[model samples]
Target: MLAGIKSAFNNNYVSAEDQGARPLIANRTAAKGWETFDVVTNADGTISFLSAANRKYVTADLNDHTKLIARAATIQAWEKFRRIDRGNGKFALQAVANDLFVCADMNLGGVLYANRPAASGWEEFTITALSSPNPGTPDSQPSTGFVVTEQQFNQIFPSRNRFYTYAGLVAATAAYPAFAKTGGHAVERQEAAAFLANIHHETGGLYHIVEANKANYNHYFDYNSKYKVVPGKQYYGRGPLQISWNYNYGAAGEALGLPLLSNPDLVAQDPAVAMKTALWFWNTQTGAGTMTCHQAMVQSKGFGETIRTINGALECNRGGGGAVPNRVEQYKKICAMLGVDPGGHLSC
Candidate 1:
């Protein structure tokens, strides 16, 4: 039965024409995102295979009448797959939605969909373990289980080490999973680039930790007293993402296990805490926008939407070409460096 990790087999079972999430095929060869699948035990004794890239479960399309799609975030009646064992390392994934088995149309190069009721050859698939720490090819196409590597991160930022010490940045790698989770928003390179670009703009290529021009840093404590009651401490802009205000300090502190509310200076002094706060804000906060910055980039909503997500109410397109353009330009440049398509939606 289900014991270890397994990757999707996309050997000629899917059409070459179909790509991305549409064709819904899997493959091996040490890829990160697509090649990895986690088997989960359901309460009803059934199982689910969650894709590492899309972060969704294999679901039978209720709207299209059994059209199989791997885009469900939760396990519902339509999402649970009945794994029927036919022995010899073969199993058929029968969809609970229509009681139909997952059939890979080999004729179409393997466009996965639900159509058959019986466990046949097309529905049968083999499971294996996952092992691909090899940074993935190009780092563009979505892959899982691979860290960007210190060398690559340094090369990307060049002078990043100038602000964040090598030891500190390396230590932050432990927290990389928070942003690059198997089913999280920052899993994709485009999303990663968009995040870095915004943070880079905020911190000037990781050169500064605290805001330099601002004088009334302590004003944050008085103006937003509802967040944290720090009689004299100032929760000003600090860290790579410049986490500011008492509310943000409290939230970031709570999220990263740091007492930012009591000692907001930790964000300015500690590189790991600074980066963590930045990533925390990027991955979770919606601010004035409808989605998180991670969601904006992952969903192809453009870099502009990220701006909106960060400070849309004031600094968005309405900033009169003051700040939003700067972020967009930097994001585009970073995308160019990464060799991944920027994928439109550039402005707020």
Candidate 2:
């Protein structure tokens, strides 16, 4: 049920895909460090987990498999992903006719699917040998397992590792100009990793539900409440990534090739538009070329600095609503994820 770490083996069964796994389960006789919890691709284009030290595969029965269940519910295109028990005590992944493998799951009616393209980070798994965990009665879409042990899950799943990551401000910024110019300042790899980090924190490893407790803080702000739409007031939040505020909404709409809306509610209804709006805000409004949200943090020592700057310019804070404090908290949390001292450090 759980796992322990073990020493590296002299076995030559290791393949290119079997490399770089952190030991999740601890082994009593094994050393403290060795390659253990590994990720690899299957022939069917789905990801496979490997446990190097124990030489056992992680397989789940169809009833116990959460990932496949979720995929089956949403994407009809996944009718083919079957879980087959390899006779030698392993499982093989296979797809159905006219169906393909998607690397990501859906959130809010949107699914981030991937294909076998090098640019999209797709890799092909080479099966030197055949093995099976379940025999004759394999499900059309069978359950799969991590080749990892319990120790590996404890060690690797808790932190920002390759096992989990997602798109957020970082992805929006890097992929588009609006976010990159203002708040989305991370370079290619950094931005990619950060986006995944933010999404990981938001959705818990990219496959879980967007927790209600963590939703708004990670999502775009204004769309959470629909009853607050005032005639001339700023509608700040909306969408999966939660792009907020009148200025951001308007600007993001233009960048994403959607119609401009001063209201945040519009973002939530159109899922693709919501993503576009987020990208718009991150790329143009928050980076170096424009308002520079991160730079403002360097100057004023917190997110409060950017809020105050926006308030001063927009006159929206005329009522003294106290958005600065909230901004400071969000900014601090993001900084902490990067392992930076929010109060002590001025330069990022």
Candidate 3:
């Protein structure tokens, strides 16, 4: 489905009426920025067909042989092709780049296809009817799940990457019970990963501690900050996870048996503090208290929504913080990459 969509957008196919004819050759010298899909140059002034998946390259030479680029061991026999209309003014053509069947859109510049990585020219074909190893539905989506196998877990934990290990996960689970669980599909891991990915993207990385050498090393807030309006000594960056706002710091400090009001910065440095702060945020469900825009999206849409929200937020704010864009062309690319509906949030 994705390949066909990409192929259509790339203009890689021919109609039934134009049977056995070749596609127009690309005049561009560099393959880096071909405007349409599969718009590759051929040696004899011909062109090669590229797919959206970047697989199955076809050429007019060798009598238009259809061969898999990766394997190159098998050749598809030439056969007569047909076209079938799929309603909505769209047509499904047969024998695409390498005689593959496809239902695609006509190429339009700066459209959805123009935003994809393969937009620089590639051939794509619909192979949904093909069988697979699992044999249930084609699961082409790249899983963003942080749930790693034992071997995978061992590879990431107890070291510089400890932030993703079970130890790091424990704090997140303890702080945000609803979001983080001990077992399978813990919403905590998802939310934490989303949070971490966001902050990392915002501030550089997890190890980029803002208050690395403060007397109150555990807190995240700068007590000496010129903008400090709060009175308490620890009212800077309280709680554990997000170490939210000033008022919430006092409230969380009182609830969690800490001087969160006196030294808030602790949360950003300590994994335990960060976890607790995050928990408080989820538990209270207030923007000032604990909940965030990201949390809201997580509750409503899931990880993808959270990431999209963050992406939009970053793009709109240019790092200054503001309203996020509801629609972005890259979002469609991401949705297509994930094999999900790009029009709305996920059902879960």
Candidate 4:
């Protein structure tokens, strides 16, 4: 479903009028700056159309039945759209508030109106792919100050280089820098290094994918558990960062477009999926706190805070201790290798 949506809308520029008092309309031939929109999926399962012109959200007004406009960057319920596929190349967007589909009045020069009695041909839309705005060309999006060159990546994991592989890391790094540098726990070099270093420590420099104790794999099964183990599947640690347990695998798989709940081995077998799982864990998991590992690193909260954010209960004495110092030391070493000063706050 996500692949379908992303393939259809991810990079296209949306140009439609809002059903507001102003009746916002885009000139198809000579569209204004506010006319273009970029599609982004929210963590909460809603779809957002971010205006390419000013980077705001295409929002619906709850109070005014006919109002829809590009407004806030922060999403609310009104900003969400339920995309209804019409089985053909067409689709309709049903407003969450009134359950009425948006109607694009082609006769009125592409003006938008909603609160219709039912979804009709006028409410249906056929999306067309368009070129994304050149990323590097935008002055507003400055280069993230840190990057891990292939040369540097090779140097970081010398012994387990074969397992992690320079090519695999390069592919992962290239695929994510834009996403990592964009929002939430946006990546700076320091933050990137911290994440990589922790995964290195977790995987013993990337040699280990699945955890040990192959004999007791079935112990992961428990009826009341959140992520119920598959009847014959084992959910141990896998991937670069060792995503252990059933729940972690299920959540990560859902987010990464994989079915790891039944096929947990995918994390250990597919290099691209493995790399993505590590990133998904880092960017989303709050561990023992409100802050994600990425957020903790970039917000100047220090590497130690990230430790607490990731495994404070185990490594910071919340559940157990003995491992905090080693984590701190490893973080510092990686920061040095990356050529960035490990900023303050290095202990849990």
Candidate 5:
């Protein structure tokens, strides 16, 4: 459910119009069946707004000035939005097709358009959760657990490689039941945000599947560690958090019951295995810090500590160059999307 926030159209709710080829409009005085929409979180981490009135997906028609219409039968790029939370109980929908904000154009009789360059009064909308007995239906609200929905994940990393999938991340959570479920709701959300922020930093907004500099590919081998490096394997950075080194691969492989030390490419090839290796480090390893990343958030040690645990040697203190600030900024952005306070001690 979305209601317009433009001064003159504050009371109007988005309506699918009269089905058929009619475009969505923001002139409905009351949010009834036609005004209600199902916020569908897709498996690929994008979101689709399904009109409850006609059971059709809303689409940003690129051929029609990106006018929003409720005529799509299936979810596609044009049907998806990167929902942006404004931290004031309002949000703006950015079309996945054009990376433009959806605007309720008052000058055009409150017609919805995905042509706005930025979110403002005409692009802001308030969402209301409607109660429903059937939880799987489109009208049901999103779950409170984990906090990062597939849609939000897609929103955070719009340009992420297809390999770093949201489904893989969810499946990897099965390995560590307490990964993001340890603390209360807010803590859970913070922990998720912190981990993803670090991952975003490491993978360059999830665009890289492996380390970019090929020169560093063979430099992560450690001979003194208990886990022996395989004869021909190279344990360079891979996956969301870029699990690196021979010992780390050996340990992660042993824990996840995979031949990661020898078949290190699995971390880069298999999405679930890649995510599992990252989670293995988050829940278990302390790296240069004294506590695991999980322990940092669950114990309210702040997001800074998580960064310390992950790469304190290179990125903590004032040694990080721009890395630390980038991670903190990403964390704050994710927290804003989740509607949670990015607690103090933001930087190391």
Candidate 6:
């Protein structure tokens, strides 16, 4: 069952209205026959939502800016959606046909449309399994399969702010499925330890939300990038990795389908978003180095390579002003906690 996040709709479940076209709307107060959808995970990893209303596949109509309608007779490209887990049982559906998120657009009287470039509050939905005793209630359990357990994470970052939740990090891992799951158990634990250690250094044991240096806040805006800096918005260091610069924000926003270029505050505001941004940089970006932080770990390149990929410009070899040694110590400590060997080449 899919429920809208907008206040105007009052978290109503989506209903495939029975009529000529069977348009999808977020006005149902309860999940019954028409409100339920069978989430089909395709062979290609894409998803197809089969509406229980008419036993038809949900289609994002390409002719109408991808308006969601349960009228497709068979599964096609327009029926495929990428489910982006937004932590806490919420998810955003991105239409494969348009490469846009499906939004419960309030402007259209709660009609669903796959037209949003980014996944904001409007695009988010709570998808509950109907098999549960309480149909609409989300599962209370934290997402599973992550290498780092909540207990282990809490023990690692006991001083972490409430915003940096273990659940949020677990949920963010869904965005990059192969994050700590890539290598074998030992390597996976090493990767998790390395990532947590880096974040610990950046956030000062997860105590800080934003960069502490206020003087450098306004300096992150880039005048020459394609991503125009929005006036009054500061692209300061934010999230676990503290992603900075207008171009980085824009690029991450584009990849994650969030308006980070304009609403950079989302990274600091939403815990799940913050973790997602951090994971985005961890799994993709190779800032100041040759390989991504993820590659540095999974490829057996050592923890030092991870540091180089993250902050080599300042911390690789030029003494790192004590930052490099601190990172190494933290990595070793975390590796010990996880019972994994702190592999060689511990310094960049």
User: Judged by TM-score, which candidate is best?
Assistant: 5
- CA lDDT scores, all candidates in order: 0.64, 0.33, 0.35, 0.62, 0.80, 0.80
Q: Go through the candidates in order and give the C-alpha RMSD of each one to the true structure.
A: 13.4, 19.0, 14.8, 18.5, 9.1, 20.3
Off by over 4 Å in 5: 1-146, 319-321
Question: Could you tell which candidate, 4 or 5, scores higher by TM-score?
Answer: 5
Q: Residue 291, candidate 1: how far off, in angstroms?
A: 1.2
lDDT of 5 by residue, 148-245 (tens): 67777898899999988888888888899898787765677789899999999999888999999999987998999999988988989999889999
Off by over 4 Å in 4: 1-146, 173-187, 318-321
The global Cα lDDT (0 to 1) of model 4 is 0.62
lDDT by residue for model 6 over 197-219, one digit each (tens)?
Answer: 99999999998999999999979
lDDT by residue (tens digit), candidate 1, 127-224: 65443322431232223333333444565567763557545644664665545443332236567677778877877777777887678676666454
- Sequence-dependent TM-score of model 5: 0.62
| Residue lDDT tens for model 3, 1-348 | 222122333433221111112232222222221212223222222322333222223322224233212111111222112334544434433443344442222342212111122221233332222122122222222132223223323422223224433455454544455553332222333443444434433333333334333465335454454435355444433222334445566666666677655666666556666656555654454442123434654464543454443343345325423323322333333222221223344211
1 versus 5: better TM-score goes to = 5
All candidates' TM-scores? 0.55, 0.31, 0.37, 0.53, 0.62, 0.59
- The predicted structure with the larger TM-score, 4 or 6, is 6
> What's model 4's lDDT at 129?
38
Model 6, runs deviating above 4 Å? 1-143, 319-321
lDDT of 3: 0.35
Model 3 / residue 178 / CA error / Å? 1.2
Predicted candidate 4 versus true structure: per-residue lDDT over 18-98, tens digit per residue: 422244342343323444444545444556565544434556666665656665534557666788888767777777656
Give the Cα RMSD of candidate 2.
19.0
